[model samples]
Target: MGIIQDITNIFKTKPKKEQDKAAVDRREKQDALHKAFSDIQQQRLHGIISTLKELSTNEEIKANLKQTRHYKEFEEKVTDIIETYNRKLDHIDPSIKESQKLTVLPIVEAKLKELDKWCEEPTKTDKTLIWKNIGNVIKHSLKAIKNIGNKGYTDEIEKVRYYMKAVKNAKQNTKEAKEEVRGATKTFNS
Candidate 1:
C-alpha cells in the first residue's frame, strides 16, 4: 500500500504552481505591452490634437491635414492599436477581447469619420477668396459712405465711373465680336 501510495503521488503530482507561474509571466508580458501601447497612443493622440489646433488657424497646416499622407499616418496608428489589442487578447480570455473591442473600435471609427468629413470641405484658398471678395465689397461701400461725410466723395465717384466705363467697353467689344462672327457665318453658309 505504501509503495502504491508513493506511485500514486508521483503520478498525481500537481502542476498548479507551474501553471500559476506561467500565468504570471503571461500577465507581465501583456501588462508591459499594454503600457507600451498606451504610451504610443498618448503620443499619437497628442500629436493629432496639436496638429488639428494648428490647422484650424494656419492655412498651410490646414492644407497639410487635407493631404492623404497625413490621414494615412492616422490610419496606421489606429491599426496599430487594433493589432496591439488583438495580440494582447491572444494571451487573455474571450470575454476580455469583446470588452476591448467595444471600447476601442468606436473611438477609432469616430475619429476617422471626422477627419474624412473635414477633408471633404473646400480648400482654404476657395474659402479665403469668397471671404475676401465679399469683404472687399463691404469695405468699399463703407468707405464710400464715410467719404460722403468728408465731402471727398469725388474720388470714389470717379472710381465707380471708371469701373462702369470699363464694363461698357467690355460689352461693346463682346457685341462687336458676336456681330463679326455672325457675318462670317452668314458668308460661309452663303
Candidate 2:
C-alpha cells in the first residue's frame, strides 16, 4: 500500500523546473501590470497638476480677485503652494521597492482635489482647510521616508523636514500678511 501511495504521489507532483518556470512567468506578468498601472497613475497626476496650474492663472479668477488689496500676495502664495506641491511629489524616489509611491499617491490626489475645490471657490476661511490638506501631504511624506528604511536622518528625510518647517513658516507669514491687509483695508475704508 505504501509503495502504491508513493508511486501515485510521484505521478501527481509537477517537476521542480516547471514549477519554478511558472512562478517566474507569473512574477513577470505581475511586474508588467504594476508598471503599466504606475504609468497611468503618473499620467493622471500630471493632468491634475496641469489643471491646477491653469486654475492658478485663471483669467476670471484673476479678474475677480485682482481688486483685493493683497491680491498680489494671494497670487504669489497660490503659486508658491503649487510649486511646493510639485516639489513634494518630485521628491519621492522612484526606486522604492514596496509600492510606497502608490500608497502616497492617493493622499496626494486627495490634496490636489482639495486644492482644486479651493481654487474654484476661493474664500478666506478655506485657508485653514488648505493648510490641513498640505499637512496631510507632509505627514504622508514622512511616512514614506520611514517606510524606505531611513532612520529619519537621510538627506531625503532632512529635505522633507525642511519642507515641513518651511510650510510652518509660510503659514505664519500668511497670518501676518492677512492681518496687515485687514489693517490696511480698515484704514482705507475709514
Candidate 3:
C-alpha cells in the first residue's frame, strides 16, 4: 500500500521537465493566438483607413463637403483618424523596431529584481501577505502584457499599480503597529 501510494503521488505531480515543457507549450500557443488576433485587427484597421481615404478622395463627396462650413473640420478629423490608426498599426507590427516593442521577459525580470531587493528587508507583515502581493504584482503585469494594444491593457497596468501601492501600505501599517506596540511596552514598564 505504501509503495502504491508513493507511485500514485509521483504520477500526480508532474516531473519538472514535463511541467517546463507544458509551460513553454502554453506560452507558445498564447503568443500565436495573440499574433493572429493582432494581424486580424491590423487588417481591419487597414481596410477602414483605405475606405476612408477613398471617400476622402471622391470628387463629388469632396465638392459637396467643400461647400459646408464643417468641411475643414471633417477633413481634419478624417486625417487625424487615419494618422492615429496608422500609428497603432505600426505599434502592433512585429516588424517594427525592437525598441518600440514591450519585451515581457525582461520587464518581468526587472520587476523580480526589484522584488528581491525589497524582500531582503524584513517587515512585520505576514509571510503569506508579502508573497500574495508579490504574486498579484506579477499576475497583473502579465495581464497587462497580454492586453497590449487592447482596451484592457491600461486597466491591467492600473491593477499592477494598485497592488504595488497595497504593498507599500502594508509595510507602512506594519511599521506603525510595531511603533505603537513599542510605545505600549514602554508605558507598561514605566
Q: What is the C-alpha RMSD of each candidate to the true structure, in Å?
A: 24.4, 13.0, 22.3
Name the regions of candidate 1 deviating beyond 4 angstroms: 1-14, 58-105, 108-112, 124-190
lDDT of 2: 0.54
User: Per-residue lDDT for 16-106 in model 3, tens only?
Assistant: 9999999999999997887776554444334434544643565644654454454565466556555655565466656653323333224
Q: lDDT (CA) for every model shown?
A: 0.46, 0.54, 0.55
How high a TM-score does candidate 3 get? 0.45
Runs of candidate 2 with Cα error greater than 4 angstroms are 58-61, 68-81, 97-100, 113-190
Per residue, candidate 1 scores C-alpha lDDT tens digits across 112-180 of: 454444333322434423223222322332344335424454464455444333332433555688999
- Which scores greater on TM-score, model 2 or model 3? 2
The most accurate candidate by TM-score is 2
Please list all clashing residue pairs in model 3, or write none if there are none. none
Model 2 lDDT per residue over 15-78, tens place: 8999999999999999998877666555544443454454357564454445444456556655
In angstroms, the error of model 2 at 151 is: 40
Identify the leading candidate in terms of lDDT: 3
- Assess candidate 2 and give its TM-score to the true structure: 0.49
